[model samples]
Target chain A: MIDIHNLDIDMGRARVVSNLTARFETGRLHAIIGPNGAGKTSLLKAVCGLLPSATGAIRLDGHDLTALSLRERARLMAYLPQERAIAWDLKAIEVVALGCADLSGEDSLKHAQQQLEVMGLSDKAETSVFSLSGGQRARVLLARLLATEAKIYCLDEPLTALDPAWQRRVLEVFKSRAAQGRTIIVSLHDIGLAAQFADDLWVLDHGRLVANGEPEAALSDEVLRQVFNITGTFAEGRNLRIDPQALPEHGA
Target chain B: MRVKSLSLAGGLLISGLVLMGALLIVGDVPLSGADYIEAITHPQSLNGEIVWGIRLPRNLCAWGVGAMLGVAGAVMQGLLRNPLAEPGILGVSSGAGLGASVAIVLGVGLVPFAVEASALLVSLMMSAVLMAFVARFPDRQALILLGVGISSLCGALMALVFNLSPSPVTTTEILGWLMGSVENRSWQDAALCVAGLAVAVGLVPRLRAGLRLLTLGEETAQSMGVNIRHVTLIGVITASVLAGLSVAVAGIIGFVGLAAPHFVRALGLRDPYGVIWPSGLAGGVMVLMADGLIRVMPASGDIRLGVLTSLIGAPLFALIAYKSAKSWA
Candidate 1:
């Protein structure tokens, strides 16, 4: 379990995440949803130790995260940033294999290949990552993240550029990884996907954790209307789906 | 795959050696195949003096300096993640040049060894300053612009020293060194290059993983257990030291460092690890060939090594820039 206590993230003079307190349990997918500029990325960055917090503590499995070395933290949790432009023409497999930078073993390549296959990129393993489409590249990067085999994952918009089919496949991959008792905290833009795949959803607005609970309870029509100011219907059935109707007129 | 890359490295090394041999045998003083053998066997002969004292040292110096520039260029490009990054274009050469000019003007390099040592020190300091400046502006275009500005500033400083010097002869002497040449350089220069090269090559294995991870960008590399700031500092220092060695030995031979790695990549090997050795070999070949051409070329005045390298390297640089621009478009 990962516990964040009163986390406040500041970017220069501006406060991005303020007094954010949350706990992420293992073997469950926790989704962070917020509108644009809602400090979703900043919060995720702080959780991954990419951003420093002046007035909070992050504990990973009872150990203080800030006290750990960068290498130690990196080995414990893998992070994937939102911007995904790879600067080199490395092969897809090579990109994935680099996730094993801290690992020194003979089976690293095999593990990387397995992860590539998990992302349905086995065929393009030898192809240069630049040659792949944006969606394919996204999958390849996902494979890189998967190759880490870390205890926790902090992903920011990992679903970008993925098609609907690949989106489901990626969520399935995350679900399976979570099933192995790994903690996952992901910031997502798609409410429907979050509602469908995530075990719990945390609504963030202006850097505060507005609501946190099971998706069915947290993503109610009233909360959705209050936070996003949109009319939406939520139903828990055989085929889970959330359809947002319209943005109400101002002050209506 | 590893084997194939190693073979390519081997081929490059063999080709570099052949070019060096060709340069050694065919110079202003023509020697037959038998005379070449005789020079090697008997060091006391007249032919031996020409071969050992002049050709061997000059060619070795060329090889060492060329390799240094090439390796340094590859490291810079990988570290900066900018194809246009090279020691020459990024003001590292000019920085070393300015440092050398300072040493000469101040009479600090009254001894030849002191010249190289001063140049290396100043070059490292300049690189650290440049890196610090670059960190302020993270954008690519801003970095390039800063390099240009810094390079011009170094050039202006060098010119200022020349203008202020009391002796016209010193100005004339420094001017020739500024143009850069491997001519009349002795084994001591070659030895100095080897020392610098040892420093450079020693830092390579430490940087290899970081270089690969760095190609993915700073954030990702850091996530993958790379200390981005630390690696970049060491990388810049190493590249600066290599460029300093080249400058100390041959003045300011431009573009070999910039063009060599690009040349190697264009030929097929794209891995940063694969690029390092072959790039060094390509650099050595380029300098050897340039030096050889100048030796044979019939010119009214002295042919400067810097001019020849720039003549070839500038066009290559232009080509790379044009291609990169087109790709971006």
Candidate 2:
């Protein structure tokens, strides 16, 4: 379990994540959803120790996160950033093996191969990442994330550039990992998919946590109207449908 | 991939050995196989004196400087995550050159190896400035721009040194040093290169894993337990030392570091770890061949090794830039 209390993240003079307190339980897939510039990515970055400006207490499994060494933190949590442009022409398997960097070379390669197979990239394992399509590269990156075998996985927009089928498959992989008692925290833009696949939802608006609970309770009508500025109909056994609407004036 | 990388490495090693052998025999005073044996056995003989006193040290210096630059280039490219990054891009070479010029013009030879000592000090100072910039910005583009800025500043300072040169002889000496050569280099120069190469070899293991992780970009590499600051510090220091030592021994040789990694990459070793040592070998071969060519050429004035390397390296650099731009497009 991860516990965040009174967290504040700042970029330059602007605060990106305000006094946010939340508990992320293990064995659950928690999805953070928000519109652009709503601190979704900032919150995720803070949790992963990527944000040095983040202040307040973050405890992972009852230990202070800030006190832990970077290697120890990495061993506990793996992060996949949204930007996926690899700088070199590393082979797919080689890129994935970086996730298991602590392992012996042969062992890391073996684990990386397994993860690549998990992502349905077995055939592309030896292919240079530059030659792969964007979607394939995304999968390759996802495989790298999975290869970490960390207790907590923080993925920012893992589904970007992926096809619908692959997106579902990726979610299923995360769901399975969550089932095995690992905590999965993902910042996603796809509200409908978050509702379908996530066990819990955290909604943010203007650097503040607006709502947190099960998707049905957290993504309330007020959240849709106030945060997203969209009216949405969400019912059990039906697809979520949202309509874009103009923001209502407070006086009117 | 392993097979291909190994084969490429083997090819480069064998080619470097052949080039070295050819270079030993094909100098201005051509020596037969018997003469080589005699030169090795009879050190008091005239041929032995020529071979031992001049040719060996010069060739060794060339090989050492080339290898150092090549490895330094590979490390710079990997650390910056830029295909075009090299020691020169970071102004380390120019800073060393400026230092040497200062030492020469000011007649600051109060101590042994004063020029070399000054060059190393300045290059290291440049690297320290770069490290501070990296810590402040942590952005690759910004780091690259800062490097360009430093390079320009060093270039201007070097020009000032030339303008204020006390005598024509002093100016000529500075000019000759800037053009870069291993000509008249002694065993000390060769030893300096060997020391730099040894340091590079020691750094390779420490550098390999981090560089491989860096290909994923800094943030992701950090997420995977890489210490970005540590890696950057080691990389900059190692590269600066190698480039600095090369300049101290052979003046301001350019493009060998930039071109060597590319040649290794072209031979199917794309990963930073696989590229480094072979890149060094390729660089040694390249300089040996260039030196041999200069010796065999019929030019009126001596064609400096630095000029020949740039002549070959600049075109390759352009081709690489074009390819990178095309890929971006």
Scored by DockQ, the top model is 2
User: Of the candidates shown, which would achieve the greatest lDDT relative to the real structure?
Assistant: 2
Best by TM-score: 2
The C-alpha TM-scores of every prediction are 0.93, 0.95
Q: Tell me the TM-score of model 1.
A: 0.93
Q: Candidate 2 — which pairs collide?
A: none
Error of 2 at B161 (Å): 0.9
Q: In angstroms, how far off is B109's CA in candidate 2?
A: 8.4
Model 1 per-residue lDDT tens digits across residues A1-252: 899999988888888788989999999999999888888998887777776444699898999988988888888999899989777787898888888765654577778889899998889988998789999999988888988889999899999999999888888889888999998889898888888889889999888888989887888667677777766666654133445457766335
Model 2 alpha-carbon miss at residue B122, Å: 2.7
Q: Write the per-residue lDDT of candidate 2 for residues B26-117, one digit (tens) a residue.
A: 56687877887889899889889779978888888888888899899998888888878888887888999999999999887445578887
Report the Cα lDDT for residue B163, model 1: 87
